[model samples]
Target: MRNARFEGKVAVITGGSGGIGAAVARRLASEGAAVAIGYRGNKDAADALVDELAANGGRAIAVQADAADAEQTQALIDRVVTEFGRLDVLVSCAGIEHFDALENITPDDFDRVFAVNTRGQLFAVQHAAAHMGAGGRIVLTSSVSASKAFFGHTLYAASKAAVEAMVLNLSAELGEKGITINAIAPGGTATAMAVEYGAGYLHPELAGKTSLSDWLKTQVALKRLAEPSEVAAGYAFLASDDAAYMTGRTLQYDGGMF
Candidate 1:
């Protein structure tokens, strides 16, 4: 494959301010794509990333938009088209995970998780589809929790499960347009969110017992957490022309964590 696989393309990545999203943005931009970083609140981080990309001879812009809001989501696509004059790739990486057991889950929490993880992804693809032509690639971020029964992830898993289903239906609907829609389901990754969720981290209370991180590692064949860049590489592949024949499938980059 060419080093500049994304050259002359334009990509919009939601939640590009940090974590897997930021890693994807950086990888795409480095490969010569004009990237628009969609951020909800952290303008500083977004601006800093844009500047860093520019400094490294990459074309990038930072846009402020909340993925949970339908209007803002549409506006995000519009802003990217206005700035870059086209949209070739859309990566819906904006998501929030609120872990609550079934008995403790709230209605608001359910709505919040679906608002960004599920609804946001749908609208992002719907609007981006309008601007994309042949060869457009859409990548959605999902999680292993979508299929695996994880503790305190009822709401989060449900939202991602919806995304996985949507990818299949949308692939059939959009295939004629030559647009490929797929998803990446990552396992325990070394991101700030992972730390907050007790992945690959030491907890004092669980010191004597089996820690969450230890238990998770043992479950994975790799026996380790995946790095953000490792997950981003999956996004890069799906967004590239090399993955043209693959669609409607959720690629699991979960360190063999089924």
Candidate 2:
């Protein structure tokens, strides 16, 4: 990727309270884009982040909106444009993980994960695209599991698979309109969700018993999990004019997962 900038633009990042969402928000703001940070919960974290960014002369606002709710999702789009005057980019990072084998997974589990991860993202892009014209960008979060099956991650993997497929089709549908749609499929990222559900619980042996760092390092060919900032770097590229020619693609940010 080339050096990219978002000067004088506007971006909305869903699930912007913490983790990758917050990282992306800060990165975009630093590059001169006014950002709307949407979070379903974690007001303190979101508000504090907004304050920090504003103190640094960055434009940002924290909004409470559940991506899974179509009404609220549309409202989020309206609010970003209402505040910033125009919408240039939409990044849907809202997602949840419920790990279990196929037989152990429940219907509600499937619905809940898909509701926010896949369905919510679709509505967010739809509403954002409706408000945006040419040069609009849409980046959705996906996972390595979407392509490589992970044990006990049946539901979560399926949800990401849905996102990957939707983004491909969306790219084709939005191509004529000059709107680019793509996904960032991260692998072994150091997010709160990864710490809690992945390393902490699912792979406690890796987190507690041995050298956690070494354990995690061994899982990827590059010998480390990605920082959220690293993943956001890809988003920054996709949202910039540098990536204008790219669409219907999924950029994997894994450290070469083995």
Candidate 3:
């Protein structure tokens, strides 16, 4: 029998109920990592995914945890460790996007965005790092919008930029413990979050000029939005031994949007 890449590993994916998070959970489990999926409010979806993985002969479990809450985030890490015995990979894919003009952006909205996208991811790592030993890998989800200027994306962009910065800083801190920290910045993925943002909310200036779908295609060299699995593949690679030497860098999987 051919050996799987992660035969003896365990992985935890935040926001693993859907979109990129679900895709990553599937990918890691298929590669032989026992996976624990963390979801905020979608217990049904998370449970369904766990069933699907089991049907395919892969091991998986679902846990309910709000990433935006630090205590809950730490509990998530603890739950994964308890279930799988040890954690080898941590993929922080839980995030939110709030698109609104600067004049209309509320303090609460800004804080909420940062709470999930930045602060939550930071603590997830901080706590997960405790259980992760040598050869542990941490991959964060960032967005191409962080570096690109988009109307009404000030808060979302700022939060993601902070994520990338955290990846760089944590790499050095975690390196001494033999852990690798990195991020994947995707551009215009066709996830539910992206579709909602594209169809319903856009900058006031471009509101009626064109559809968000068409506008996004024109911006990407590929002329199309990425699939969740495509972005998940990058996460898989970064989590594997093949990327052991890589850390503190953000890989742009934006379909050449940069």
lDDT of 1 by residue, 107-213 (tens): 88888889999999999999999999999999998888888886667789899999999999999988989999999999888888887875323334554588666
TM-score of each: 0.95, 0.93, 0.95
Clashes of each: 0, 0, 0
Go through the candidates in order and give the C-alpha RMSD of each one to the true structure.
Answer: 2.4, 2.5, 1.6
lDDT, residue 156, model 1 = 90
Worst 10 residues of 1 by lDDT: 198-207
- The local lDDT score (0 to 100) that residue 100 gets in candidate 3 is 79
lDDT digits (tens) for residues 1-258 of candidate 3: 634888989999999999999999999998899999999999999999999999988999999999999999898899888887999999999998787778998889988999999999999999999999999999998988888887778899999999999999989999999999999998778888876776544456677888877776667688778999999999999999999999999999988873
User: Is 1 or 2 the stronger prediction by lDDT?
Assistant: 1
Location of the lowest summed lDDT over 10 successive residues in candidate 3: 198-207
Instruction: Give the true-structure RMSD of model 3.
Output: 1.6
- TM-score of decoy 2: 0.93
After the best TM-score superposition of candidate 2, give how far the Cα of residue 134 lies from its true spot, in angstroms.
0.8
Clashes of 3: 0
Q: Local error of candidate 3 at 153, Å?
A: 0.5
